[model samples]
Target: MPFVICLLFSWFLLPIDSAPAVASDPLLICWNNQVKPLQNRFVQLSYQEQRNELEHSAEPWQQTPYQASGTIWVNATNFRQIDTLRNTTRNRTSFTKTQADTQTLLVKHGDDKLTSVSRAMLDEHPLTAARYSPIRLIEYAYQHHLRPDSASSTNQATCYRTTINQTVISLFIRRADGLLDRATLLAPDDMLGDVLTTLTYQDYAAVGPSQQPTRVIVDKVNGKVRDQVRLTQSIVTDQAPTLLDTPADYRLDMTPTPVATARSEKYSDHVYFVTLPHTDDRVMLVEFTDFVLVAEAPLNSENGELIIQQAHQLIPDKPIRYFVFGHHHPHYLGGVRPFVHKGATILCSPGNDDYVTYLVQAPHRLKPDSLAMAPKPLKLEAVGARKTITDGQFSMDIYHIGSQSAHTSDYLIYYFPSEQLLFQDDLVWIPKTGKPTRISTRQTGLYRAIQQLGIPVRTVIQSWPVADMGVKTEIPFAELAASVDSK
Candidate 1:
C-alpha cells in the first residue's frame, strides 16, 4: 500500500472520544469552534471539482502533471465520488467511481464492472476509499470524534495537532473567522523519504448555510505543488433514499480473488517461469547446484512472498541466493523488500544502489511488513555493462540495455548462452493479432544490443504482460528481427 493510503486508514483506527478530558483544552475549544458552524448545515451536499495534480509514476523524481474533473455527492451516511482522467499523451481516457457507507464500499474503474468490499477492508487497503477531498475530510471529522492533542498559535492562524496511531495531523484555522485555512500531515514515505503534505484552502464562498473553499492547493514540504483543486459548482438538497446505492445493472464482485497460489511452467530442467494469478506479471527462476536465482519481483510484498514460496516448491531445499531487478520501475521493484528480508543479494543496473537501499531501509512502521518486523541490511550489487553469474553447471548473464534506448536507462536483461535464450522486461510487446505492422524504438534498441554483443539468442521470454501471442511466453528471435527490419 502507498504511504498516504496507509496513513489515511490509520486515522480510521483512532480512538474517538466524545469530548476532551478537560473542557478547557484550547485545542479542543478551537476544533469545536471550527466544526460547530457546519454541523447540521445541509442534508445533502454535492460539488463538481477540477483537479490538477503532479502525480508520481514509475520514476519517483519525475512527476507527471495531469488534469481530472469529477463530482462528489455526500450525505450524512453515504458519499459518492466520480473522477475521469484523460491522458492525451497516451491517448487513453479512464474513469473511476468510489461510493461508500458504513457497511460497504463500491468502486468502479473504466468500465461497468464494480467491486464491492466491506468497509472494514479499508483498514488494511485504503486505496479503495474515496480520493482525498477537503469536503470529505471535514465531513468525516464532523461526524466522527477528532481528539486534538495540542494547539499552537501562529501569527495568522491557530494550529491544532492530533496524533493517531503515531501519524500526526495538524489543522491550521484562520484566527479571524475560525475557518480552516490549512491542513498538514507528517508521514514516512519509501521513495520521498519523510514527507510533509500540506493542503491550503482558499477563496471561501457561501454554500447554503455554510462556507466552502473554492480553491484548495496541495503542496509537499519540498516546495513542490502536488495538486490543486477548484470547486466548480456546489449545491445542497434534501437527501434521497438510495442516491449512493450500487446500480442494479452494474456487475459487482464481493472481494478481490486472493492470489494465494502461483502457476509455474518448466522451460528446462534448471529453468522455470512463474506467474501470479490474475496478473500479467511473471518471474523467472534459474536453479544452480546450491542455490536459485530469481529474476524480477513484481507487484507488492504479498506477491513477493508467493514468489518465494513457489521457488521453494519448484526447487526444494536450496535457498534463493540472488534476486535480479529488471528495472527501477515501481511495479518491478515493489517486491524487492521481501527479497531483502529473505537475505538475498539484490542485483540491479548501475546507479540504483541508493534507491534499492531506500526500499529496504525506509520506515514501514505505520503498517509493518516482513522487513519492518525483522529488519535486514540490504545486500546490493550493481551490474555494469555486463556481469555473469554461474556455478559451472548453470550460468546466467546480465546485460545493461544501454541508455541510448528509448526505454529506461537502467533496464537490464538476462541471457543464457548455452540455452540460446534471452529474458527481458518492457522491451518487446507482441500484439495478440498483428504481425509486425510497425516496430517501436524499444525493440530496435534490444535488437541493436543483441547484434552488437553478438549473442545467439534463439528465443526471447518476457517477464511482463503474462498473456500475449497465443498464451506462450516465448517469442522467436527471428520474429523480432523481422519486425525491426520491417518499415
Candidate 2:
C-alpha cells in the first residue's frame, strides 16, 4: 500500500507539456543550463564586421564608415585567448588579450608586441573582452539587480526580460533554449536625449556540445546600423591556448594623473583667452560690469571648475552669469553642468534648448556631481542669428554660423568688436606655430563669414590648437588668408 501511494505521487509530480509553467529565476536558469555547459571548451571564431568610425565632433564632414574581418579565441571559463581585427581600408590590424592567470587587459597593433594595461588600474576598469563572452555576459547580469519583468514561450523558445538602471540596459534571454537574444542600452546624452545601442544575437550553431551565436548586429539609437559580425568558422581545441602570452618589450601606463594647468592671457581690457595644456582647447572669459561671461565650456567638470576658479580670482566680486556653448558637440558641452551649478544661465543655439534642459535635469544619483548635489533649477537662454551684450563700456556680439558651415549647422562664434578679436571653435583649429596640414572646408567658411559680416578682425583666437606647435599666440587675419591661399 505504501509503494502504490509513492508511485502515484511521483507520477502526478512529473512535469507535463501542457501544464502551467513553474516559476523560475531567469538569470539562474540561463546560467545553470546554458553557460555552465560551455566551461571547458576552447573555442575559436572568425567573423566579418563593419562599424562606424568613432569621431570627436558632433558631425564630421568626410569621415567614412569602415569594414573589417576578425578572429576571436576564448577559453570556456570566461577568459579571452585572443581577438584580432584587421581593417580593410588601410590594412591596419589590432588585437587584445589578457595575461595568463591574471585579469589584466592587453592589446597590440600590427607588428607590435602585446601591451598589457596597468595592473593597478585593472580592477576598477571594465574589460571589453569579457563583456561579450558567453559566461561573462551571464555573470554581469547576475551582478546587477535583476527583476524578471516578464516571460513568454513561442516557437520552441522562452524569453525573459531584465533591466539595469544606470545605462538603462534591457536584456532579453531565451531561458528555454539557454540563449541571450538581444540587449538594448540607452544612454542619455547632452546632444541626444537618449542614445540607444542595440545588440542582437542570431544564427546559433553547435560546437563541441555548446551553442554560440554565429552572427551579431549592433545598431545606433539613430536607427543606423553601426556594426555587424558574422561567423566564418568555430573550433573547439584540446591543447592549452597560447594567444594570451605577451612579448616583453611592449609597454602600457595605467596610472591616473592630475590635469595640467591652462595657459591664460589677457587679450583685451576684459577679454581673456585660456588654453588648457595637453588638450590645446581654449575657453574665453569676458568680465562684464556686474558678472562674467564664459565662452566654450570644453572637456569636463574638472576643466570647467579650473576655468571658473580663474574667473573668480580675476574678478572676485562677480558670478559667472552666462556660459555660452560654442556648439552641440559632446566633447565641448561636458563642462556646461559645472557652470549651471554656479547659477549661470546656459546659452546655446536656439534648437538645443530642449537637450540642454534635459541634460541639467537628468538624475546623477549613481555618480553624483556638483549639479546633482545642489539640485538647482537650470537657467537657459537661446541665441538666434545675432545677439549682442553690452555693459556701457564693453560690448560683445554672438553670431550664428548657419548650417552651411562644415562642422555644424547651429554654431556660434564670439566677436569682440571693440578689441577686434574673434573667438573661433571647430571652424578654425590652428597649430601653435605653423599652418594646418590642410585647410579644412570649415576654415574657409569662417574666413568668408568674417568678410560677409564686415567686422574688423585684427586677430583670430582658435579654441583648438595643436600642442607643441611653434606658433604665435594669435593668428593675424591677413596671414591666415595667405596661408589658406597657399594651401
Tell me the whole-model lDDT of each prediction, alpha carbons only.
Answer: 0.67, 0.64
CA RMSD of each candidate after superposition: 5.4, 10.2
lDDT of 2 at 141: 58
lDDT accuracy of residue 2 in candidate 1: 23
- The parts of candidate 2 lying over 4 Å away from their true place are 1-40, 57-65, 77-101, 111-116, 119-127, 130-132, 139-174, 181-203, 217-228, 239-245, 249-252, 260-263, 403-405, 429-437, 466-473
C-alpha lDDT of residue 135 in model 2: 47
- Clash total of candidate 1: 0
Cα lDDT of model 2 by residue, 97-178, tens digit: 5433234456555456655466543432222333233445555555443555432334444433333333444456775565
Over the full model, what C-alpha lDDT does candidate 2 score relative to the true structure? 0.64
Name the weakest run of 10 consecutive residues (lDDT summed) in model 1: 123-132
- Residue 338's lDDT within candidate 1 is 80
TM-score of each: 0.75, 0.74
